[model samples]
Target chain A: MSLTADDVNKIAYLARLGIDTQDTESYAKDLSGMLDLVAQMSNINTDDVAPMAHPLDQVQRLRTDAVSETNNREAFQKIAPQVEAGLYLVPKVIE
Target chain B: MHTKTIAQLAKGLRAGDYSSQELTASYLARIKQHTELNSFITVTEEQALTVAKQADMALATGNAPLLTGIPIAHKDIFCTQGVKTSCGSKMLDNFIAPYNATVVEKLDTAGTVSLGKLNMDEFAMGSSNETSFYGAVHNPWASNTVPGGSSGGSAAAVAARLIPGATGTDTGGSIRQPAALCGITGLKPTYGRVSRFGMIAYASSLDQGGPMTQTAEDAALMLQAMAGFDAQDSTSVEREVPDYSAGLNNSLQGLKIGLPKEFFDDGLNNDMASCIETAINEYKKMGAEIIEVSMPNLKLAIPAYYVIAPAECSANLSRMDGVRFGHRCTDPVDLNDLYIRSRGEGFGTEVKRRILVGTYALSEGYYDAYYIKAQKIRRLISDDFKRALQEVDVIMGPVSPSPAFGIGEKTSDPIEMYLADIYTIAINLAGLPAMSIPAGFIDNKPIGLQIIGNYFAEDKLLNVAHQYQQVTDWHQQTPQGFA
Candidate 1:
């Protein structure tokens, strides 16, 4: 259950987070410890038990498809890192 | 004026003992004097005075709301329009919320003047306040001790009388643990009891917002305004919010109190256990019948919680990329670079640890072994609480294992910090309402008596804590310098 350096790199990449090279070893250690703790759950028999998603087990409520929110594009985009003409500018994703 | 509880302040405001403007000024001054405690992140002095004046005009009309002219603060986790809602993360350091959270809106409508946002663990992640991008909040009781968080500032401010009351969110003992450590009253209402519309999401299923105050009576007043249904939050309950203060003075005669055997086990500090036992004895003197109940799965809560909360947090926090409203990195060559560096730079060490753990748990080939298994264990833990509550009106236990530890004491070890919440985490998993009240002091550090109730049973929990506060003066003892 020990997360090696390779495992840390894979997980961090999967999470889209960049871990410092020096910190990767420590991350590996911490993640390994957490895995050990969560692994304790395997000791119990949950074969027939259902996975509880919500505390009250209530289903997500549906609402009408009609618009319920006011447009606040300008207000929201005012704090964006890069925005031009009401569009958020991001790094080029495609050539 | 700052020493008075919310109830007393309300009475004084109505009786003209002092103007709301005067009261707000007094509290603002107190907050300035105790700045060393690091309880506040953003103090809204100008806005508070303006709101205080409006409250005075409303009071002059003779039909002002119950909370009108009262000064309180919100845990930075809540969205306060025009005020910085940092959520204790550099990611949101520069982001100003465009609107108020439903809880903030409700309390504002009740005419409560907000002092400003208080500090918290970054995105409500850690047990102690150390994970905050803003420096850790100090417990007023002992200057060097850590204030239990992620509602450390709310608890510390209320305990020091810097503010009459403040709002706090509890995912895994965020509100109750800090309240226990700071010697104040904190209530974590039933999941969805308070709307989470504008509150930042940490663990969606388990996160709940409630009141942190000096006394249960004040907590009841705050909860009355805070509790309700909001169409904005799909999980917000549709049930009626009862009169929270009506049953505060209810007799505890015939009360079936459950003392879970697991809570008094080897992990609990002996001295702290005696203080809790003494509080329970007082409950017995008032005609409460104590019944020993066993909740064996209680021991498994921490592990299950670490799995589920982080898994949800990892997903929820995925929205904090560079393009959106929060912090963004300098130059990035591509989208992946943007996402990775922004998150890496924005999140703290503890937050990164959680996100990584959650990502691994929910990742390919490991989802069933970690996430699904943890959820099943969550069900077993909830079942344990359901069975125990069936035999008792409410359950009693120590809120935290021991009193507040020194700053940096448990920060190096995440597991040790997580274990400090053993007593309070299970209630969140079951979605039951619970409260933490100052029971007594251990070596001048405070310990809280946890009162847990059935789902949506906030009134009962408040009554239980209120009755105890009536006989004991522990809740009244303020820290020396602050007083």
Candidate 2:
């Protein structure tokens, strides 16, 4: 149930988060500790129980496909780190 | 003027005893004077004064709302139009919300003056306010002690009389834990009771907005304004919003209070047990019959919660990538580099730890073992509450394991910090309405008596807390220097 340095790196990569190389061992220890805590759930047999996603057991209420929001592109993009012509700019992926 | 409750302030404003402008000024001055508490992240003084003047004009017409001109602040988690809504994270430190959260808008509609945004744990993650990027909020009772948090600023500010009341959100024990630590009243309404539109999401299923105030009466007033259905938030409940203050004076005669035996075991502090017991004794005198109930699944709450909350947080926080808004890295070689470095630089240690854990838990080959397993345990914990509440009107217990710990006491150990929420976390898992009221103090630190009720039982919980407040003066007791 314990995580290793390799597991920590794999998790960081999957999460798309950068972790300092020197901190991997410590992160491994912390993550493993959490796994140990979470491991306690094994004591109970929940094979017959249905997984509850919502607290009230209510399903998502769907609505008609009508447009309910107005375009506020200018206002919305005002806080972006980089934007031009109503487009959010990120690193070039296709290139 | 600063010591007056929201009810008293509202009455005075209407009766011409003091203008809303004067009250706003007084609270603004107090907030400025207590800079050491680090309770507020932003103070909207100019906006508050302008709004107070307008409130004064509305009051003159004799038809203003009950909360008219009352100065209050919001937890930084709520998006406030044109105001910085940090959620106490460096990622959003520079972000100004384009629109108001439904809670903020509703409060404004009720004519409550906005004092500004209070600090919180970064993205509402930690139990202690120390996780906040702005800095740890000092407990009003003891400056060296930690103010219980993610809603630490709201609790501390209200306790220090910086603001009469403020909004707080509880994902885990954010609202009630801090309220108990700071010796104030805080309520976490049932899931979806209050609209979550524009409220920065942490754990969507578990997070709920409520009032952190000096008394249950004030919390009722705040909840009356904050609770309702919103088209903007799909999860918003469509139930009727009852007059929360209407049942404040209701008799507790024949009220059945269920006490979970597990909460009173050796884990509870001796002083906290006595204080909570004394509070229950007062309820007994008022004709409440206490029944000891056993909820075996309660111990699994923390483990399950850690999994579910972090899993949700990881998905929700993924939107904080470098492109659209929030922090972006100075330079990036590629898209992956942009996301990885931006998130790594923006988020704090605890937040990163959670995201990684969530990533691992939901990854291939482990989703059922960790995520689904936690969900099943969540149902078991919730069912335990259902069984207990079926037999009693409400459940009463300690709000926190103990009073406020020293600022650095448990910071080195995350597990210890998580365990501190043991008494309060189960209620959130069940999505039940619950409250923490000032029961008494131990070693000058506050202890809160938690009153948990069935779903959408906000009125009942408020009534129970209000009746208790009527007989006790603990909620009235302010920290010495602040008073």
Candidate 3:
């Protein structure tokens, strides 16, 4: 499956990336190259094999249901792009 | 001081031959002298001296361990509290980590003085350091040549003797490829061997932290402290980490080494293949047995890894959206603009390319065709390793297809660069332990011999590498001008 400029632009949008129009053409080419490379998987018959998601093949370990973490809002917010009153502030969403 | 290995330095400190302060200071001077290599992204001088003095106190008290007072650098992927953990990207240029990664905290307990965070490919993507936002790391052997990545800076720093050792992460061939190109020893342990609590996520299943050092013995010391179970990291293994340093002198008699038929098939460089044969002959003389093994599914490692890694990265990096931490756009129209522009300006071309690929693979319509199929093929690739390891003690092959290439050699074409990791990526796909040790050279550029072992077989891999070093001096051959 080859990716066109529109397909790449949609991918960039889904990825929340602002890909410039000029780079989209190049991206389409590169993405198609990658797609062509991965298309070989279709030839291999993995019909009975289970998809291995994790290496260890174990579920995530459960922990106690309690407040284990300390309050580090001040420390955490220090690196925030914009923080006000210990809250991360972003551009207005609600109209 | 600059020429000594980690073991020699530790012995010197124990015998009162030199203080940790003197060693740290000497290394700091060398790091400054070799600034042209662009190995270091940040050098924590004041903190290094402070830690060095503390190590000296421990030495004076006669309570120092093997790594006490030794100066080392960390790949920026491991977050260091109070330091700018850039991961070699502009996205985190101003982001100071709020806490230390498990690896960093373990090193602190070992009393290793940190030089600073080293450079890496942006978010540990890319086959060469060319993708690093800071700049490409220059090969110590040749300035115009590239050091392999994403552990390029770590390999270059250790290779140049700026520091005795460093920490590196391998999601694919990151650690071993760079180590091979720079003529050092780098070990990528079993997937869950080292805790990933604080290390930045790349491909979560494949990413692992390990040691980059001058010798296998030194790598053992570093890996000893770095491996363990962590409650914070849900995926960390719950097993005992044996004394890796204790088994370095083990005998190699009757050790069955599998020579993968797939590794030598077309695409390997001629001189590099010769060097691999020489190294294999060395092992034969050491009383080891060599057998040919065919891994028919190994050819699919590249495609499987490219798909699986990016898919995970797309999800992992989604958290970097502008609101919480890291780079943010200026005067965004709204939330969508903030994310789009911040990511656009923040990520490099290679990183963006991967994110786009990953997003498409994991998207609604193509999920089964790309993402799930890759995962199924991942199982086939791993099963081949299981079968091969059953016949031999370890698998032997070239770490990279060739010696270090020129800086801009393959950067223009992504496929060409991706093939550079052909031999090394299969190990990470299987989540097994593997290492790269300097074997020989091609036209003065270093080549590496890759040793791969079954799950949690780090000791056996290090033992074989250590025995090889005992017979050869390739790891000791430094870059001419730097020496």
Candidate 4:
């Protein structure tokens, strides 16, 4: 798939990256090259092959349904960009 | 003291040759001398020394274990209880881990001193250390060239003698490739051999933490401490992990080594080929037999990895939304704005590109065409390894197509960067154990011989690497000017 200018723009928007119009051509070119390289898989004859998701075929073992973390709220919130009243603060949505 | 292996250091500490405080200070001093390499993201001198002092006290009381007081560096991806685990991205620049990863707990119980967090590619995405948010790690071999990433810092530190050993995680080729570039020994054990409870996810299925050191024996010593089943990591295997260092001198006589035909194709550099050939010949002299093996699906590994890794990364990173921990945006009009702006400002170019590609591949109409297809191809790659391993005890190949490339050589072209990982990605895709042993030098730059083995065959891989190292001085040779 060749990426159109509009497609590149949409992808950038969805990815939350700010790409100016001038950079679109190069971005499209690069993304196209990467896509072209990745497109090689389409030619392989994997018709009878079952998809392998995990390296091992074993089922995932379950851990006890218990909280492994403690109440380190004060320490945890220290890295937040913006916080108030021990809660992470964001812009008002319903206003 | 600076050049001693981890085992040697541990033995010396045990024999009262030096106190833990003295050993830790020597490493700290070496780290201070090699700041230009940019191997470390942070140096926990105060914490390390305090721990070392306690270790010294324990030694006096005759209560010290093998790892007690040995200073080691951790890749920035492993979460520490209070240390900032950045994963080389500004996205988590201020984020401190609330709990210790299981590996961290194990090491702490062994009494290993925490040197600090090492630098890496952002979210373990890049093949070169240039993508790190902190700075690029210089290959100790050639200052202008890149150390392979995203575990470049760990490899660099060990190569430069700044640290005897360090921990690194491999998703695609992070550990092995960097180890190759830096002329050190690095191992990526079978998928579930080591617990991943505290490791920040890249591609969950492919990620496994291993050791980087100057020799395979040092890697073994470190791996002995790092491996084991952990109830915290659901994927952690419940098998018994043998003492990896116990068989370092094991006979390589009659051991069958497979040279994958695909790995030596046109893309491989002549110098790298010659270096690997020399290493193989050295192994032949040591009584190991070499056989040519074929893995036709090897070519598809890169493409399959690109799809699966990004698809998983997209899902894993979604939890980094501004509403949770990590970097968040300033005042926002709503939660959506908060997430969008925070992510926009947080992630680097390569990371954002991956997230976009991953999201698109998994999107409504493209899921089967991309993600599902990649999964099917992934199986074929694993089967290829299985068939080859049945014929040979271990496989040997070039860790990378060439030695370390110049910084900015392939950064502009992401495809080139992806291709740089061609030789190493298949082992990760297959989820088997592999290691990069310092084979020889190509034009003053180091080349690595990749030793791959069957699942849970870490001991065998280390044995082969250790046997080869015993017969060759490549692991002992140091880069000029630095030495």
- Judging by DockQ against the true structure, name the best candidate: 1
Q: In candidate 4, which residue pairs get closer than 3 Å at backbone N, Cα or C atoms, i.e. clash?
A: A91-B332
lDDT for model 4, on a 0 to 1 scale?
A: 0.88
State the lDDT of candidate 1 residue by residue for B64-167, as single tens digits: 99999999999999999888999999999999998899999999999999999999999999888989999999999998999999999999999999999999
> What DockQ does candidate 4 have relative to the true complex?
0.61
Q: Which ten residues in a row have the lowest lDDT in candidate 2 chain B?
A: B230-239
In order, the Cα lDDT scores of the candidates are 0.93, 0.93, 0.93, 0.88
Reference A-B contact fraction recovered by candidate 2: 0.80
* Model 1 TM-score on chain A: 0.96
- Show where candidate 3 strays beyond 4 Å: none
Docking class of 2: high
Tell me the fnat of candidate 4. 0.65
TM-score for each predicted model, relative to the true structure: 0.99, 0.99, 0.99, 0.97
Query: Which residues of candidate 2, in runs, are more than 4 Å off?
Result: none
B1-483 in candidate 2: lDDT tens per residue? 888899999999988999999999999999999999999999999999999999999999999999999999999999999999999999999899999999999999999999999999999999889999999999999999988999999999999999999999998889999999999999999999999999999988999999999999999999999999998888888889999999899999999999999999999978889999999999999999999988999999999998998899999999999788889999798999999999989999899999998888899999999999999999999999999999999999998988999998898889888888898888888899999999998999998999999999999999999999999999999998899
Point out the higher-scoring one by TM-score: 3 or 4.
Answer: 3
Better of 3 and 4 by lDDT: 3
Worst 10 residues of 3 chain B by lDDT: B415-424
Candidate 3: residue B439 lDDT (0-100): 96
| Clash counts for the predictions, in order | 0, 0, 0, 1
